[model samples]
Target: MTKTTPQTNRRIVLASRPTGAPTADNFRLEEVAVPALEEGQLLLRGQWLSLDPYMRGRMSDAPSYAPPVEIGGVMTGGVVSRVEASRHPEFKEGDLVMAYTGWQEYAVSDGTGVNKLPAGFAHPSHALGVLGMPGYTAYAGLIDIGQPRPGETVVVAAATGAVGSLVGQIAKLRGCHVVGIAGGAQKCEAAVKELGFDACIDHRAADFPEQLKAACPRGIDVYFENVGGAVLDAVFPLLNIHARVPVCGLIAHYNGGTLATDSAAILRRTLTQRMRVQGFIIFDYYVNRPDLHAAFQQEVGNWLKQGKLHYREDVVQGLENAPEAFMGLLQGKNFGKLVVKLD
Candidate 1:
């Protein structure tokens, strides 16, 4: 049996930097002191933590917009935690909030970066995925950048993923025909049946390009770029004139940065087709509009209740299995948004 101390917080830390794909060995779990809560701070016990694609970037000391996670530091992520004890008046015991608490069972908050969540919200875990960062990303990028016209075709890969799933559903609501590209047959079925996508093509098929071409009859008006390798290559030739491309994520090439080369013909097509390709981070938009969060909280909540918006989570039972679940994420093993559960 394991011993526990009231002052000790269990956490997962970066044990090693991954060369390509992060392995179970990359994470190290240890018990450490519960950090001292300052006068305007609180101690939080994590409930649900989000594991996303961006965590891969933090594992290495790469020159990027966000700082890298040090070898010994906690793995960075979003957390839905309950306030255990608060010295801060803004929060009291049992308060829940959305925060960047990383991979830890307990965390210290000065109430600086943490956003207070609703008091008795059911499915608080939804705050970390849908109705949260990923949902916001799909909202901003698709509406602002994609701008799909009614009757136009919108294509997206990783269609069953957190962001991509919302993107497709939103496109359908906009009167645009949506075709999703996912890995396996199961994900494709879920995309078409449950998510209400017009059709879904499996990227793992022997002739993906052939299937995608068959799916998008009018060519793609809005291409929500998620997995950027062979899938991007297939979609490149199908983009119609004046197509809008929202560069959201590149999960396929994320394991190892596969900087692909665009052919001269494709470059020529960009000029000939007049494609508008834009890449954005959601932080820029949501920062100016706190109301967006409130709006999404209402809209996504209603959709879930009305059975319009559906989400699937690949939840792991223990903190010990988190590393394996996370590692499987980069490879498309997890069927939905990956989250770790700890009692």
Candidate 2:
């Protein structure tokens, strides 16, 4: 099938660094002429763009595991695209691929760091969610770092989200009692009913800490840390001896929030409990452990196929709506893995 080359590429670029939460003003949309592909290059048309909490950190110039998105540059993100045209030997036109092509309608790539989607893959969008980065984050963080054992109590924050949902369900499959902490009652319900969490607490409730403690009568053996402000404050006291805390993200503090003041107490507890509080970036695993990624693809992919795992996406339509959707994501407004379906 012949594909028509796109003349213009529409992209969202960073206009200015955000102080607190990002607003629509921080992003500027531009339509520019598509550049011709050179040798060993591919022209990609983005179909789906992922919006994640980590992008909030990239919006700031603060010291982080990854570099900040430069001013006037396209906001950094992973995209699932189709190869509209290719001069690259390894890729061909009409192949679906996953790449870090940012928030754009079209991109030119030299095929570096690009992974072709398996032919006839049922859900291509899953490459951006369950079968992709978020899925790996949950798998590695929970299995490798958290190391949940049978009958242990595991608590996951942001429980209905892409990572947390998988974390909780995986814990259940491993024979652990999984408790989830989510924002509202509806999400809390979904965490238990849809995601198969043993119990889910609403962090927005006034008695949230009490409820979390009540839910975990055996004490938390593993805490998958995602939203780490008030949730951390509540979970800290209930951690069992030798508990493992895999700190994947701190979304509550992403928008220039205050640091926790009770560091001394935290250290004291860590010392007494012999807790393993480790932080990890998924990129490190990708570089060091390709085997784990393969194992994840096999195991999780099977679970999905057998209808043992669940995944969700809160999709937004159009490139023009991405900024507003992203802003909503940081505020816990999105119900699941947020993605933009580019028009």
Candidate 3:
């Protein structure tokens, strides 16, 4: 069924750059008239908006891989949206697409980077989570950089989260023993039981480091680094000789906290153990890689359909509540892949 276009578009724009943790004051909600679509452009109504940890880096003007969102710009993000009006030949009015339309209710795209969703694609929001960027991050980092061998022990922080959950599961598929580090007892339990992690330790516990060490008796062969602060400190000593580390996100220090990095100690470990610590952005693998996307979707998608993989989403309703939900994400209040459902 074709959808009617709304006259007004509701958007959450960056009011001011965040100094530390982003607050509600840093965002401004505005209702503006939707502009007329040009020829070859399609009007999109956002259905699901992804809120990820990487967006935290974009909030600041720090020297990073991608440029920061300028003041008054719509907060940048990926969205699963429906085409309401299409002048583009490739898309129809009722077609679903995965677009980088940010945090706005409606947007117009000329099919530059938009991907038409597969017909009967189950769980469209999975495009923003497990079957999308987060899933690719986990797969590329673990397989290419991590190089997990059979019988190796792999550990990942944020075990119940979007990327971490898949990291652990894929490691298991590669015949490695997978251990997870999560925030609370409940998340830890879910990680072990639901996600098929061999063991999961609670990071909030008093002796978190000790608990992690105990779980991985053979030492960590690969450490998927999502949280950098205390978790890295704990994982450091447990890393076996020649262990690989794929640094993805640092959610622990994203809201203004020092990463516990002793240059001398890190160098000492690097020299003595011959360990490899590599930082990678998923976009690097994704760019100009139709082969990678096909391989990932075929392998991971099959596993998901076969019940070998699991995903969770912490969805908050409405575009207006995005600021509040995003703030809670920085504080570890989100249970899984955090997304805002624009109603």
State the local distance difference test value for candidate 2: 0.93
TM-scores across all candidates? 0.93, 0.97, 0.97
Which residue pairs overlap in candidate 1's backbone?
none
lDDT for each residue of candidate 2 in 1-343, tens digit (9 for 90 to 100): 4656679999999999988888888999999999888999999999999998999988889898899999999999999999999999999988999999999999999999899998768988999999999999999999899999999999999898989999999999999999999989999999989999999999999999999999999999999999888899999999999999999999988886654649998899999999999999998889898999999999999999999998989999999999999998888888989999985
In angstroms, give how far residue 188 of model 1 lies from its true place.
0.6
User: Model 1, residue 188: what's the lDDT?
Assistant: 99
Model 3 regions more than 4 Å off: 1-4
Total clashing pairs for each candidate: 0, 0, 0
Error of 3 at 312 (Å): 1.1
Give every collision pair in model 2: none
Name the best candidate (by lDDT): 2
Q: How close to the true structure is residue 128 of candidate 2, measured as C-alpha lDDT? A: 94
Which residue ranges in model 1 land beyond 4 Å of their true spot?
Answer: 1-5, 36-38, 257-263, 289-298
Alpha carbon lDDT of each predicted model = 0.85, 0.93, 0.91
Alpha carbon lDDT at 78, candidate 2: 96
> For residues 1-343, what per-residue lDDT tens digits would candidate 1 score against the true structure?
1423258888999999988888888899999888666688888889998888888888988796689999899999898988888889889887888899989888888887888876556688888877789888887778879988889999988888888899999889889999999989999999999899999999899999999999999999999987788888889989999999888888877686553446676678888999998887777777776776567667776777777887888788777777888888888887777888866
